[model samples]
Target chain A: MPISPPFRMEAMNNQSSEIIYTYAGPRTASDTGPFVKTRLMIREFIDARELIIRLFIRNFSSKYRQSVLGIVWAFIIPIITVGMFMVMGNAGVINVQGLKAPYAVYAIIGTTFFNLFTAGLTACTGSIVQAGSMIVKINFPRIALVFSSSLMGIVDTAVRLILIAAAFIVYRTAPHPVGVLIGFLSLIPLFILTLGLGLFFSLVAAILRDLINIIPFATMGLMLLTPVLYPIDNSSALGVVTQYNPLHYLINFPRDMVLYGSSELTTGYIVSAIISCIVLIAGWQFFYMAQTKIAERV
Target chain B: MADSVITVDGVSKKFSKSVRHMMLYGTLDLTAGSFGIPLARNRLRRGEFWALRDINFEIKRGEAVGLIGANGAGKSTMLKLLNGIYMPDLGKISIRGRIGALIEVGAGFHPMLSGRENIYINGSILGMKTAEITRQLDSIIDFAGIEEFIDSPVRHYSSGMYVRLGFAIIAHCRPEILLIDEVLAVGDARFRRKCLDHLKQLKENGVTFVIVSHNMQTIDGIATKGIFFDHGSLRYCGTPGEAISHYEMKMLGNDAPFPETLIEGSTKPGSLRLVKYFKDYGTHDIRFEDVRITNAQGEPSESFASFDAATLKVTVASPSETKTRMYCSFINEDMTVCMGAYMDISLKTGIQTIKIKFDPIQLTTGRYMVSLRLYDEYLTNPYANGHFGYFSVMKGGCVETPGTNTPYCWRTPEVTIA
Candidate 1:
């Protein structure tokens, strides 16, 4: 096995022979067709693994080192949001219903899962714009930036998962053993959907500065629409809109598995998993094609 | 063709003049590109102009190619294209080796991170592996000359320290092809010399170089070949000397020939003759008609005895009234300027002669060249400059030091007892 440098994927030839990179007339890697380009992109990603790890370390360390609260900010944010919603429930501002488990356990699990999508989406969307200087100066694989930022999101979510674990212990709520495993497996689709949309929005957000400002609000509104804080009201008109929301099934399936050990939403989960895969494939293709123009605009 | 590491063939690039059109067209093009819709790339749309129009060049392996042009002459665009930061619109560019660009070093440095930690991050961004960075860690720190502050956060580092560390990391990457912009003039003068020496060593070790600089002396020192760009078109590509002269002529907008051919009859009784090789640049408000060195006997001569008095007479032709200063510098064969003299002159619209006398010209025995530069009264803008000729100084003065002379006397020592 050859130990090539991590920034560039070598061509088929060895080091002695030259590797020719020809760029012409607004063309890019996708001109080779989607399948071949995707294969090449995978190889480039593999070659850029070390760079991804380094960038992740850089972002992860710099982000918390400057803050007074440090890593606690990750858990504190969702904890506060959960506290506010509980206060509203106590005040009778909103009705909390349809829970076999305690409302604290239910809401904490839901917020943790929901945060995986929202934070991941936000991080991925801003990755390219935040790395604007590096993008213009260097010729490294751009997908590495997204991957590193996505790792940050995953780490953030992992921190929040600790809060969920603490909530379970504090409430003495016993989750179904088999359901725990199934609930963890269900997070795969949610993560895939977040990364997929992140790939799309990151590129678009880099071009349009307005999307950078619009995304947090959009995801906040999405959280309300997806029933992340409360049980879905099936009889309400707003609940009808939730029927088409894929995040509803992706987030709810995991929570239902831990609470009920099985869910009637399995069919909906399967459909949403397929949708997530589709978004991922399409978003990857779009990101790959448009990345070559990024330096010029940024 | 196999030996050519970089080949840019008929490449052209365009940019939008207005920010609104740039965003609009960028979005439209991006959308069209994402949808796989082929648009007319060769044609320019509204509010767009060609930044580079049909440029063609090839750089062979182990060659140092210097790129020279005025600001916004597409030199930077060409460098960006070569580095794969931008794709061409009308032609193709092919490059064959791992490239290390010193275009803007320290661009990726995180201010909050320690210098030692940022080195690993910047090294990886430049394509060095972690193991490689670890191996070169001590050397990088040594090269940056900041061992004491390596662990300090770069936010506290001086700007000079920041660039030094950045350059140190990239320099150790051992790239096959190196691209340098106007970044070599960083840090202090000693550090700048160190960088140039290192670059020279790299060149000897067969690292191909593409340097873009406005400093002609630097380009002439390093570049085996020079490419001059004017108005987005390649105006000349040849030897470094010829390319620089051509570029300088264009910059001054002068039509006069550089290094005028030899002539016989111009030498008069009391005026010195000029050598065949001479370079001159000016606005033609005033021109050097004749330049000569006269010995103590008051006759033009090329060879002077050491410790003898000499007069440098410069005759100028001016078409209008102007006040300018003449600066004449004596340079040895090593091209080191030994001594210089200046005269402030106000000339009317005619030919006139100005003579500067040097009493006891004490330059040691050697051959030396005379360069005359005419500047405005404040000595800021250069109006004309020329190396008129060279003169020889023969052995006559007391044998003393090897460098230029300063007036001195030795007092007779009196015997004393303490």
Candidate 2:
């Protein structure tokens, strides 16, 4: 098996080559052509695996170059958000209710899980445009940017998990090991949803460029609407919106599965999982349609 | 043909001049394309024009081909297409082997990363394995001559250091094919000569190249074949010597902007083809007509000896009264301005003759073009300009100059007994 790099596909001799024969304008088969053939895309992913990991490390390492706190900066956001909510609950500004664990622990875990989605979506969506200099001059598998940028979420999640572990130790409460395992598994749906939306928006952002401004703004908005800061079982019109929101299920389902062993959120989680899968598949198709022309635009 | 690595067939790429319009039209094009209803293939939408059209060629493995053309002739676009930076709208370009392209300066290095770290990042982007970069890391640092500062962020490095590091990383990639755009001036004269020598050495090692440059002499030395493009169309394909001559002739001609159709593929070696493009002076402004160069005897000549006096007789005609300052610039073949003289002369409404003389033609054995640029009194906005003609200093006893080919003798100062 030859481990070719990205852009190396099956040649004419190997899988009939992308171009089995030469072509001029309007080759007879162009209209019927797959926007991006699945086999070719899969091969590209395989070839680009090394590049993806390298880029991920580059992004992760360069991200905190001059910061004084460095990787510790990852813990500050969740801790700050949890602290603010705890203070609000004490002041009687809003009732903190329905979290099965201690409120501080509940908010910390929720922020940890929610960060996965926000970080991944932001990374994936902005990767191509941020690396616009490399994109325009060199030709490599562009999808590498999508995967590599999204990988930053996994890195951030891992870093923040240490903070969560520290939180559990301080609280002197342990969740069911099997339920925690289920929580870990939920990362699949969460990652898929983030990656899918990212791939789709990358092309859109490349065109409008200003569209990326909305991604972070929108993610911040989604945080408040979802169960990141508060409990999910609300009794107002907010409950109606939260009930239908897929992100609501994604944020709380696994956290609930681990902290309480079970919650009335199984169906919502499954539905969110299915929707994420569809989004991932469809998003890749859309990314493929735009990927070839993206260099010109960027 | 069997060993060919690049095949570009009937490729045409169009670009919109306006960015907002490009975004809009690109959306419309993609939306229409999704319906399997092909959009208009042969029409230019608003603000849209063809950057390249009907470009066709092939590059066999191990062949170093040079691309020569004037600015905006689509040489850069052709290289970009081959590098897969731009997709062809009308045809297919199949390229084999791992490729490296050095398009612009700074080689896209991340500002926040150290030179050492950016080497790995840029190398990975260029498709090199981490293992490969590790293996070549010492050599790259050594070649760039920045080992001491390699650990510091490249953002703080001098502009020359940045270019050196950028070039060094790409040079170490060991790609099978290299596509270089015209940003080759990375450092001082000595560094440029070293880079040129390195490029020649790379060619000897069986790496293929399709480089675009305005330096005909560099192309002549490095390329086995040359492709000449004029206004997005391939005008000629042949030996580097002939294509360079063809390009020079077109520069001097007075024909239609660029002939729609071109005589494609090789002409005889060192042969010249003149393509005259004359822009109408139109209802206003000045006319630079009839330029004559004379050697020592005052007879018209195109070749001169070193340190020989020469005079340029320019006949300028203006329809309306205009006070024009005449500037005679000596330009090298690569179009680098060497030395120039300014004359604060006023032109009458009709034809007036002006003579500017070079006391000693202080130049070496090389080709040089005398550009007769007519400027307004402030010497800012050029009203009319063209190359008067070219002259050659055939032989010389002088030592080679440092920064240019224009000859000057070496001077040795007397050493005191201090």
Candidate 3:
């Protein structure tokens, strides 16, 4: 049989305009350069949000399915870890300066918050490798996978915070309203920082399988460097380290707000939020740049 | 004309096996080598290999194309690039419409989720909006034919049912461009046929398709054009028939010769006569008897059609007393058995003759194989036997291809009528 004639050929004359307008559904281009490019980026952001929500819900539901105590595992791990640390503190195995509160309460709050940060980071970092098959088969924003895993950590954190509130009520200790508000506000910056780190880690893990083994050790070290178990006072070497740690402000902001009724916003919190924003933006840019290589690598 | 839907321009994707295995830390260590001067020195040691080199093609709207290749031939890599699952290392791919892919169908399906819930989840993963899936839900369930079990967890589904549901959802996607990779061969015959028919219907509705398959017959039935890949490069791209013939030529070079006889005849009552037969008397090829049939009045006939009344007669010479059964059968060219007749009788010493007349031969219009079997029928069991005698029936002649339709032409003002 004779082969059919070749299909119509159309040369792309205005390539830049096509790329910008096509992303936003055939928009009329009135300006050139960065302004038009930003419009295309905004469209990509909207598309990414839609994909993230679905993946987040799917990942969250599948993890807890068929368990008798469905989402309670999220709360149970933090409670148990904090309880073990509280026992060490009460037995005079560790020392805390400048605090009269029960050692169990203080340890639970610190460990619970720090665990949320590290667990969220590790899970998010491994998301790309875990969903390797999906990455190779489906077409979507690759960063959605990393972000969804980080968001699932937020769900776990919400559960742990509820347990902390219950402990405070049981002990007949009232948390100041300002402290509770600060605790809630601190989560936003923590999530942003974790997401950025997760995307960077996920891309690295997808390309180099060895990163899967290394992430746990890195997160453990980060936890130790932060004051999750001990109190941070104004006049000590460990306190200076805690004050300097980027994640330290995130953990401490919530504890300071809920445990002490102080509403003073520190320069540390301001610096941490700025660092979180920079990381989140840079992390997204690096992930998108590396994602094209992931389909081949994975 | 400027109406092309896809344009792939000088695209090349190179993949190195060793570089893929290299750790991320290795790249960092190499780059971190004493800042500027050492970085230039370390770069000279890296290696590069190419998988796809300078490939180019264009697909217009409403075209159905097939991608054919051997196991490692970069056909899958090409599909991944088109779907935006992978980017080309060099050059560009531009596609102008909504694209849906069935590359590893059910890739994101969760076993714990019910079929209904998974439909939404899997649909979103394939780039469908929730509202779009809701609109297509009824059609998907109808096509899958799993409405009764839609609420059941997918873990309970058989592998076939899982694939059926996956294909059905993809079919309902209403994409402007669809990419399918060997997914049609996953289900049972009925579902496979259904998927092919649905794909054909979609092609007619102006949806462009790119199908990848090793099955030549399936590709021939659907693809208007085909591209063959050999060792990560385009070896041939043209008409489907030419592409399939090219693939078959390569496959035949690797296969052994066809067997002389696939089946041995049964031994029973009212069977064909055997003059001589041997199963292992030849080297590389088996040898058989010069078998023929005669009328009851003892006359020879060269041919017997199913419409003719005939008698079966046999004459055989044995070295000693033998107890065996005789068998006769008819089979089609494709090796489908049509009908059979057999007889068992006792023979004693040398030159034994057997004759049996059948009322009529019942068969369809096709070529068939006639086989006879002889086996020992005594000593322990009276029904055990050996086999012999094989021939063919060229009944009702061969089938012819259907005639093609001639295009009608009319006189135009641009052309002068003679």
The candidate scoring highest on DockQ is 1
What ranges in model 1 sit over 4 Å off?
A1-34, B254-354, B357-418
Q: What is candidate 2's lDDT per residue for A1-298, written digit by digit as tens?
A: 1112312232212321223122111111232456436755676788788889878878887887768899989988888888989999899876786555888778888888999999999888888899887888877778888999999998898899898888889999887778888887886899999999999888778877887898888988998888678875567888889989999888788888778777688899999999999999888877876677667777
lDDT by residue for model 3 (B1-418), tens? 1555667777776655575434543345323421322332212234545567777777777888888877778888888888887666566777766678889988888888889988888887776789978877887888888999998989999888899999987776667778999988788888887887677777766778898997665676778888888776787888876775565455433342323452444344334333233535222111122344544344555345444444444455555665565555555545555556555566655554555554444443333344445555542322222232333332321112111111122121111111
Q: Give the range where candidate 3 chain A is weakest over 10 consecutive residues by summed lDDT.
A: A1-10
List model 3 lDDT by residue over A57-88, tens digit each: 88877888878898787777777777777677
Q: What TM-score between 0 and 1 does chain B of candidate 3 receive?
A: 0.62
Off by over 4 Å in 2: A1-36, A91-93, B32-37, B250-418
Here, model 1's chain A TM-score works out at 0.89
What is candidate 2's CAPRI-style docking category based on DockQ? acceptable
lDDT of 1 by residue, A182-283 (tens): 998998998989888999989988888789899899999999999889888889987999888999999999999987798878898999999999999888
Candidate 1 chain A lDDT trough over 10 residues, lowest sum: A1-10
Backbone clashes in model 1, listed as residue pairs: none
Q: What DockQ does every candidate get? A: 0.36, 0.23, 0.29
Q: Pick the candidate with the highest TM-score.
A: 1
* Per-model RMSD to reference: 10.7, 11.0, 11.5
Residues B148-169, candidate 1: write the lDDT tens digits: 9999999999878887888888
